[model samples]
Every structure is written in C-alpha cells, then in structure tokens.
Target chain A: MLVDPRATVADMLRARGISRRGFMKFCATTASLMALAPSMTPKVAEALQKARRTSVIWLPFQECTGCKESLTRAGGPTLENLIFDAISLDYSETLMAAAGHQAEEAMKNAIRENWGNYLLLVDGSLPVDVPEYSVIGGVSNLEMLKEVAAGAKAVVAIGTCSAFGGLPAARPNPTGARPISDVVKDKPLINVPGCPPMPIAITSVLVHYLTFGTLPELDHLNRPKSFFGQTIHDRCYRRPFYERGQFAESFDDEGAKAGWCLFKVGCKGPTTYNGCATYKWNLGASWPVESGHGCLGCSEPNFWDWQGFYNPLSTTQWGGYAQIGAAAAAGAAAGAVAALAARRKQRPVGQDVQEEGK
Target chain B: MPFEALDPRDAGRLEALTATASGAHGPDPEACESVRGRVDSGNVPLLLNEVRYALERLLDDGTTHAIDVRAIPLGPGEEDRLLDALGRGELRAEFDSLGRSEVQECAYPGVWCVTHYNEAGHVAGRFLEVTFTPALLASPPEDVRTGLERLAAELAP
Candidate 1:
C-alpha cells in the first residue's frame, strides 16, 4: 500500500537512543496498563517491535479541539506517545500545516492511498440536524465523517464528544449532535471517551492496535476495557475514606483539605470508569479528585445531562443498595474463590487412598 | 533396578529440591536466582490459567479487589517466582509504617505485593494483595482524623 512513510516503534525508540532496558520498561508499563500479565511483556515488546506502520486520520468535528490538544500536548512525551506519533498519520486537520482545499485534498489522497487499511480517529461529535453547525473545508461534519469512515480499517471515537455525544449533544442538543457510532455503524469502532480522555489510554489503544493488528477488547460502551475496566471510585486513593463514610462536605472543608473522598461534594468517581485514579494527569501529578474536586464523569455518555458537576452525588448516582450489594458479593466471591484455590493448592497430596487387596 | 545410584553432588541437588517442598530449609539462593533468569516457568499453563481467572475478576466490576496470599503458603522462592511470572509494574512504593513496607505492583493491573518488616528490620509479614488500588495508600480516614486531633491536642494547653 502507498501508505505514508513509516517506522516501527522499536526503530523510533532505537533512533532516539532508548536502550533495551528502557524499551523493555516501556513495554512492561504498556502491558500493565492494558492489564496483561507480566509474562505478556516480552510478547508486547516483540509485537510492538515487529508492528507495521498503521495509517491514521484524526478528524475533528463540532466540538472543541481539546481532545487533540490534550493528546498532542500530553504533559511530557513518553514511549507510549512516541509509538503513537510514530504511526503514519497522513492527515490531522489540527496538526497538518495544509489548510482549506489543500488539507482536504491531502486527506482524500491519503485515504485513496491507504484505502480500507488506515485508522479513522474522530475527535468531535457531528451535528446532524443543522448541517451548517460544523463545516470543514465546505463539507459538513456528518458528510465528512461518512466519507472517511467508509474507507477506514477501524473508526476510533477519540473523545466523549465523538464517542458519546458530549457537550455539543447536551440536553436540548441545539445542532442535533450525534455520536460517531450513531453515524458509522458498519466499521469497527473503539471509543476512547473522556473530557479530553487520558493520553495514556489514547496511546494504549493505538499501540494495542499497532501491536496486535486488532482493536483492544472493549466494554459495553465500546471503550477499551483495559482503561475503562475500573471505576475511579473503586481505585481512588481516597476510597478508604468513602468506605469509612468520610466525605468532603464542601470544597474547602477539612475533609476536602485533608483529601478525603469526594463522594459528597459532587464526586462521580464511584460511577465513572477510567484509569484516572491510577494514571493521573500531568504525569501523575494529580487528577480531579486528588485536587479535591469531584469527578465530573465527563467520559460517560450524556455526561452534560447528568446532575451538576459540583453538587453532591445523589444516592441513585452513587453505588446504592443494588450496586453496593453487587460489589460486596463480588468481594465475597473473590474471597471464597481465593480460599478454595489456596486450600486446593496447599493440600494436593492423596494420602487417604485405601487399597482393595492389601 | 529402576533407580540409578546418585552422585554426591546430585544428591545435594535432590535434597535442595526436596527442601524446597518442605520449606524447612529454603532453596539454594544461587539456584533461585538461576530460575529467575529463566524466561518462563516450566509450568506456564497452570500459572496462566490462574492469573487469567484473577484478571477476569478484576475486569468484571472495575472495583479494586485483593486476593490475600497470607493464607496461601508458598514454597521457598515461590513468591519470587510468582511475582516474576506476574511481572513488576510501574509503581513501586516504599514506606515505613509498621516497621517498613515495600509494596510493588504487578504488571497486570489490580495485583500488588506488600512486604512488611518488624522493628528489628526482619521481614515480618508478606502479603500479595490483588486490588485495583494499591494497598499501601488505603489508610482509614478515622485514623487520620484521630492522628490530626492528637497532634492538635499535643500543641494545645
């Protein structure tokens, strides 16, 4: 295929003077992020090394360019982003120097060149009712999406706006915005939804595809299960506080100042799913909850339609009776399974066998 | 005879293997390190199945869960072997809480190991806690409040 000139992530890392240990560490970290066993580290490293350059087209639509900005300006570039950037990204409306007709022409050319083999990354949501709500190079956002998605190997809805009809699709969606899934149904789509999403999650999805040549396992929402497998509340450092019923009543109260759980002060961590609790923003400096603010659940669908961000989470919004019972059951099940497995492992000898004809 | 006479050196190795099972005397340190150097456990299939099951549970609710290893007695060097199989992840935290604690995350998310030391600095308790959140950071809020209150009282008349 006449894809853009590309280099394997290994080659890029080597060229950048990353040693074998450094590269292995990066692979190990990636494996962990994807929740793969340590045994899979070498496999991940090898797969990444031999991965072919994938062509990606990042399409921005009727939303703020925050997704693009967050990923491109990820606090500090790591090996993950290095591999992501290493891909043959022939067209990115935000990143490309070409403008107007030239940019559109370049994308069409790239699409023609890589046809049916390139990745389609859409960052913004499309407005269906008002075609003029968003236009790129004279083509409406919805039309542009259909055209590009037709030839894509897989369509990745990059942010909440594109994946779940975010801010643009909030209550009374004026422009009548719709998510990419609502538009492109045939193509395999992966949602990396967040307000701006986690840079690592975005990179993980791309690397996962590059290494395995298939989309990473996704959740019901079509978000990568590795990143969305755990709710922020389940893993937050302040969860013990929540278990102990210690909640920050106000933004500046002692609980807040003491970094207690933000469940009371509009914290949606309990219900929101992402790796923010583990992989914080700004290179592990802090996440919203760590900063003493409640999670806004920006990555979830129709997040803007949810209760206000700063208001305390309603009992229904939090893990109420049913969810709590389920969580407890899961915990109990885990304990029982572990105990049974342990007992079986410990007492493996068959010493009580009786002989028939002694 | 089916059994061949063992060499004295071979006998030592056999004894070491048996000792490994008994846990009365640990495996040879050099032998343990040598096994660590091996890329994969000869018993990959079993470990793979076990770890996979644990991983499935982890992905179910996105809630952090722990599989306490205290009850699961391990043979000498088995802990290291398991951790090796699990793979050390990005986060490695060291702190002095009850004597000292070194907590390490496994390559797979939601798996962690914490080794606590006594006041004399000997290894006191070792736990392989599997959870979405690292166990070291899970201090109760009441403890924090009491500690804060005590500190305040200490400073007051």
Candidate 2:
C-alpha cells in the first residue's frame, strides 16, 4: 500500500503525463544530443535519478539581452525547467527577483561557497572603452569579470558577444569591447557563439558539463566541437540549390519563391560554424536559411568585421565593395525604368510606330 | 689556378681565426653554459629558444646581415597591448611575425629557402633569410629543396 518514491522510468513516465513510447523516444533524443552512444540511455536515466543538482551563475555584461530572451524561448516545458529542476541557478540579474546590492552579494557568496566547484556563465562583451560605457554597481565590467572568473572551475560564454566580442568588438569598435577570453585568462572558458545560439546547443553544453563534471573539448574559438564543428553551409536545407549554382537573383524573384540558395545574396553560412541547421530554432520550427534569407553568420569569430552581411557569393575574400557594386547596378536599372516610363507617357500612339521606323 | 702556390703557413692561422671567441669565457652568463644552467630553467628556455630560433632563421641565408627578432612576452598588463595588436592584425606586420607571405625562392641556383624584406626593401636584418632558386620549383628535385626550407623554417622561431 506504500507509494514508491523510486519508480522505474516507465512508472515515472506514467505518473508524469508521458506515455511509455514517448518516454523512450525522449531518452533516445537525449542520447543522440549528448553525442552519447545509444547504449548509454539506461545509464543516463539511472544517473539522472541520483545526480546531485549542479549550481550555475549567469553574469550579464554589456550585451543586448538577446541571449536571455533566446533561453526563455526554448522548447516546451522550457529549458528553465531543466535549469531550475535539474540545476540550481544561484544568481542571474534578469531571472532572479533579488536586485541591487543583495543580488551582487548573492553572486559573491556563491563563488566563495562553491569555489573551484560551480560553473560560471557569462553573456555579452566586456566594454574596455572609457569604462563608463558599461558599469555595474560602480565596478567596471572587466573588474567584475576577473573577480568571478578567478575562482570559477569552468566558464561558458553564452553568446557571440561574450565569445568573440560579436558586433560590439567589430572593426572601428567604439566601445572597445573584448571577448571573455581576453579578460578571464585562468579559467577554462567554453564559448557558445551566435547572435542568439540555438536552445538545444545551450542545453547540450550544460548537460555535457553536468554529466561529465567538466566541459567538453573545445575548438580554437573555445566552442564545443560537437555542435560547432561543421559549417552552417554543410547542413543548410537549401544546400542542393547552392551545389547546382541555382541562386535567387532577387529577394522577390521566382527563384526565391522556389527556395533557392541565398549564397549569391551574401549568405555567410559557408564560413560560419553553428548548430542552427541541425537543431533549428523556435522548437525546431525553422532557421534563417530556410526562410529564404541569407545567413548573417553571427556565430563565427569576428564575423561582424570579417564577413560582410550582404557580400555576394562570388566575393570570397573579406573587405571589398561587392555590396556597393550591386547597389549601384540596382540604382541604374531603376533610373532606366523611370526614364522609359516618362518617354512612353510623352509619346502619342502613332509616335511609337514612327520612333520604331526611325 | 695557383692551388699549389698557396702558403701552407696561412692554413694554421686560418684554423685559429675560425676558432676565435667560440670557446672563450665571458662575463655574459648567456654565453657561459655553466652560468646558464643555474637560472630559472623555464624562463631561460622560453627566452633563449625563441630568440635563438629567430636569429638562426634570419641569418641562415646570405642576403640578410643584421637580424633582430623583437621578443615580447605578455605577462600581466601586457595582455591589453597584445590584444590590441592582435585585434588590429598589425602585430604580425609590424613585428614581422613568420607567416605564409614570407616564403619565397631566390635567383640562386639549387639553393632554396624562406625570405623577408626590410623597410627599404633590402633583405638585411630580415627574419628567416635563406637561399632559394627558380630551378628548384620543378617536382621530385624541387621537393628536396622545398623540404629543406620547410624543415629549416619549422626549426626557426
């Protein structure tokens, strides 16, 4: 008659609203996403039962807050469920109701209490220009970063801005922004870069860290190889069109309606690395490349400066005027069309025949 | 043409001259292998290896005269300086960091190696200077010279 707290995965699934088949499928997806061998699903489920909750501290610097918004928009039941239910979010300015001095104290306490233990997550670039451009509670962003990073066992830079300084550190950068690696040198920092990185990517990195008690091996840019190893171009849905060299000449062209490649229109998918193609976004709804628009390549290092957003496919090298030439050609064509219309309006019905004869 | 006519007495002096300063004891500890042994092994190797490699590479070829590789090690405050240089992509150009652009063949026959140019376009004081030639560009035979240059450059700083 006594209820069992420790139920088999199937019994637990029945208690929660998931069917046995759906629970098995969930296990399979989790296994695949973790880059784990399918044989490890049973082990993972068992581990999940006894695993002590991990602590995570998310720090926001001079950023657009897009990373937080993206995390909130993660799939059903929400990644928040995993963060709160699976892991303890000790302090986050955006998520926590605690504010001002108390919030700051909470972050400090967490670091001191969990020294060489807890994970530190950061979003946004560290502003180096004048310091006044970005300040939190009278302390420079750089100062705060060094303090937190010094004792952290591991650090995760959650967005492009935090990873490679994103747009804030682009050429002729006014804010003098720098990546987390620039300021935080001692800790092992993993960079998850993108304007707003795919939700599954965020979750996978966390799960990997929690499961292994250490971060996965990172690439040259400190990005997890499992997600960022392949180019966006490699997995793009419209890659067939790119291979055939069938590109949409204009945004509103018939080829565009047919979902032709956006490479000719300056898609940086070929150079950029991310899991957008594999994971998709908005609960696997669709990514930018599938929406008939060229990829902006927000994930790659110094992408804002290195790859022009509207650079045509033929232009391979960085820093050129391919965009300017395209704009000029369009301007000239528009002018010619306007002139023809005026000439037609002035010409009489028979004048057309006379002009043809002439 | 007058090989037999040359003085045998000069050969002894030439050997002595070639051996000059090589084994001589000096106050500078770097030249003294015994003194170099006592210094912090970590710092010594880092500095000595980097500089020695750069110097050897720069002077390997006959074209360059004086070789100077500006060795800047980033410690604490130097991070900002290094980061600024890296961000601008000017650190390599200004300090003449070894790169793909520095590789080239010379007009000399059979000989082949990497080269660099000074501010005045002269090869003097340039890093990784080596003798390279056009005939060496051909395959099989070319691989031998190219392989040597690559090996030497890798051994360089």
The candidate that wins on lDDT is 1
How many backbone clashes does every candidate have? 2, 3
**lDDT (10s digit) by residue, model 2, range A229-308:** 76776555565454444666655455654666666677777666777765566544346765445788787666665435
B16-71, model 1: which lDDT tens digit per residue?
65577436354566543332222221233454465577667768865444432322
Each model's lDDT? 0.66, 0.56
lDDT of 1 by residue, A53-166 (tens): 888898889778888778877644344455665688879888889888888888989899999999999998889899897988788988888899899999999999888778
The 10-residue segment of model 2 chain A with minimum total lDDT is A342-351
Tell me the docking grade of candidate 1.
incorrect
Instruction: Name the candidate that leads on DockQ.
Output: 1
Q: Please list the Cα RMSD from the true structure of every candidate, rounded to 1 decimal place.
A: 24.2, 30.5
Off by over 4 Å in 1: A1-7, A15-19, A316-358, B1-157
Interface RMSD of each: 27.1, 34.4
lDDT of 1 at A176: 83
